[model samples]
Target: MQCDICQRSPSSRLPFNCTLCARNTLYQPRIQLAQSLLQKEALEKEVDQNVAGTPKPTRIIPAPGGKPSEPNPSWIVQRAAAEQIVSEEKTQGIHDHVKTLREEIQNTKAEIAARKARLQKRRSEFASAKQELSKSQTGAVENMDKSMRRTEHRWDILHNKTAESRLFLCREAALLYGLHQRKRKKGGLGRDVYFVGGVPIADLRDLNSMDSFDYGLRQADSSIDASPAHVTTSNTNLAHLVHLVSHYLSLRLPAEITLPHRDYPLPTILSPGSSYTGREVPFPGSTPSHSSNNSPSASRHADQRSLPRPRPLHLDKKLSALAKDDQVAYASFVEGIAFLAWDIAWLCKTQGLNVGGNSWEDVCAMGKNLWQLLLAPPPRPSVSREPSSKTPPQKPSLSRPSTAAARTLQPENPKDVPPLGHFSHGTAYGYLATASGTEYMRDWGLQHPLRVIEKVKAMLLAERTGAEWEILEGNEWEEEEAGSEAKKETKKDVVRPGIEETVILVRPGGVESGINEGSGGTEREESDGKGRGASGWMKLKSR
Candidate 1:
């Protein structure tokens, strides 16, 4: 048999169990029970001994009417001790709560003090910043005032300089061109007036104004053939003046100039060396001695209406950009000026005048600034008339005449005469010296001359198109097309030969009207001459 606890064969007579292990297990519970019983009895004996050693409390009775007897001393002492213990516990809790509240109050005061310090620092910073802002604002205002004052002073100086320069140029130009100054009374006021060959050209105060000069030129051109004896000499002088101005300024003119004449095939242009003698053309019905006033108004109107508009001399980029009507107006204005210049040059040769002096270089040098103000800028390299070559063009040698007689004598050779562009070289130097001058010259040329050209252009355009001229930004002029249509209608009614001929058709019903109607009629008639009825065509002669 095997023992379960020891895993050994049992030597006892029990079934499948060791006799020594069984005896130990059975006696272990009994030994533990006996030790517990002994411990419980010992505890009980100690409690009984404690009870026996303690004295019992005695009870007392009081008489009915007697006061309550005093309490037992031991009971009083125990109750007093319990009350003292509770009082100590309450005092400790109160002290703890008071300490905690005091700590919280101290922490709150610290936080408030820190916040106040931060606020004070922010206030001081704000005040300093405000003072700095005030100082900076005052300084900026003072600077602005100083700059404005400086600008005003500069503007005043520039205005004075411009006025002085204009006066000098006008005086020099008048002296050189033989303009005489006179005091004229008008409207109960006396003013200095400049006269070119007895014709009032401009007032002294308006010498700087280009419009004044252009208006004067137009008046002089209209009065060219007014009289014969007195006006001839005056016109000769005027022509000399116009020639000098045009030559020195290098003003561009049309290729031909049409002068008002009685000749049938009128003198289209006056050649450089040719002399012009006024001649009368004998028509089929008119005699050579018949004056224009003796002719019928209908014949005069027909003659005037038949004349064609002159073509432009050259179509540069600027002229090419303009409308057809504008180009005609421009050509007419330039050609009129060219005629005055060309006529004088022709007359100078016929009269045997020694006016072609070789003192052009001296004159240019003496009035350098004046020439710069009057002469137009040189043409661009692309448009320059100079021949293309690697070598530069040589400057003409100026002849210094020794005696007064020699100075009065004309040059023997034509090559000795200075070229027209040489007179403008001094003006060109002024422009070519600086970038700003180059740009200004390229765009507008000299200021006064440009203004004169613009004024003449506007006047010619107004005369031709009946458009009101209006000044725009940058001193540019624009023509208003408000009354242009009416003017164009009037122009269409008057047919010019070899330019535009309006055809009128007479139907069987006696109705006569133009071949086409409206503005597009001219274009249609010129393009294909289509859509015309088979009626008889009648040309409307100007009355």
Candidate 2:
């Protein structure tokens, strides 16, 4: 047989046997070894046949004819030798398999990390949503309390018994600041102000370099002794600004003053209103009184039933945001606030409140600063306007976006429509330009600017045309519920409208001239012949 261990050699025990196979192959590890021994024995028999000690004859073994042996122990040894030759190849293959698996594991880990980031972002969004919900609830409760207080208070009784009156900024900025007040028996304005409280305009820097990051709200002491304090006439037209200031001053006032009657505007020779209450009657006193008949006692029962929430700071309240002064950044903001103030004053037809001295550009910058101050929502109190109702739920005028220019002046509402942020005086001027080129006013060849202003004012203030609300309620989903409330609550105004003075001048009827070319020296002025700019309106002198 062929030996698997020594590939080229033949086994000694094969077919029958050979003499050489008998001597040397017997030590092998298979049946062949035993067979070789038996063959050697047969040679001994041959020797016996040979008489005496004659030489033995050679024996030959031949190959078997075709069939191969079955797998036995001898075959097993052959297989083991074949397996050993292939062992290194098999080992290398196993190493490659392990390497492939490690790469796969790394890829899986990377995928898991990406998914984890997505989960974290989703969690943050959910948290913010929850916070907004809590705020809305608290706001609702506070509004309800304020509504109760205003509704139950017997305002008329307080009006008959008492009278009242109320600035920005850092004390040093008073010259550039405005003054606001609320007064009694004023038929015209609810809010009005002189210059916002400030120091000399020159002393104030154009840019607010000192960081307001460290500023904080300190609660005014709620408990104080009743005593005489500084009191002034207040106007309803400017009441919002006044309310904000009065409340702010309440925190630091050296003397406690009594509130007065309905807030009246600072007086003017010609107060523009249905009936004129001209100029404020300054109360001569070393100290102003703190007692304005409190919201009448009759009204207290209903008002006392609930915990009153604090009132929100109004337009005049000092809001400070620190941003760049350029028009692209913060100028628009200042303009919006100024516009709100000026518009309100005009609507009430109050006098002496026009924005002057400082350019509209500067006012817009101020507004931008205020936006930062509004980071957290200011407190808002709901005042009821229902006709003497003693009830569970009373309706109140929504203060947000109440004035015509309010929406125009405010920064964007998080949930409101885009492009609805505040506007500056310059923006207003652009909006009103060239509305009607053909219409002109003439009085027997003599035209007056007063007549022209009235015409333009009426046109600009006229209700919006062709705008309508659309409702989309279908299967499509959105981030928030589509709201009609936004449309209904929208208010339009410029700055604190009533506190700042405003004017509109149109040359007769449709014939109009702009403030830019009002000077007679201009060639265009001679051609238009629309007469001089606002000659005798209440705001004319202020301008």
Name the best candidate (by lDDT).
1
Q: Residue by residue across 92-178, what tens digits does model 1's lDDT show?
A: 999999999999999999999999999999999999999999999999989999998898787655544433343334334435444
**How would you encode candidate 2's per-residue C-alpha lDDT over 1-543 as one tens digit per residue?**
544444334543344344544434655556666666766675555444343333245452322333422223443455556566567678878888888888888888888887788888888887898788789878988898888777646553332222111012211121122321111123422111121221001001211211111110000122221111101111222233322332432221111121234342221111123112222332322122223335566445333332211111111321222121232223222222233333332211111111111222222222222221221112222122222222212121112323433333333333221111111122231121233211211111212123322332332223111111112223321322233233223312211324332222222222222232232121112212222221211121112
Q: TM-score for each prediction? A: 0.27, 0.16
Which runs of model 2 end up more than 4 angstroms from their true locations?
A: 1-237, 240-543
- The CA root-mean-square deviation of candidate 2, after full C-alpha superposition on the true structure, stands at 31.1
Clashes of each: 0, 109
TM-score of model number 1? 0.27
Give the top-scoring candidate (TM-score).
1
- Per-residue error (Å), model 2, residue 501: 28
lDDT of 1: 0.37
Worst 10 residues of 2 by lDDT: 210-219
Q: Which ranges of candidate 1 are over 4 A from the true structure?
A: 1-94, 121-125, 163-543
lDDT of each: 0.37, 0.28
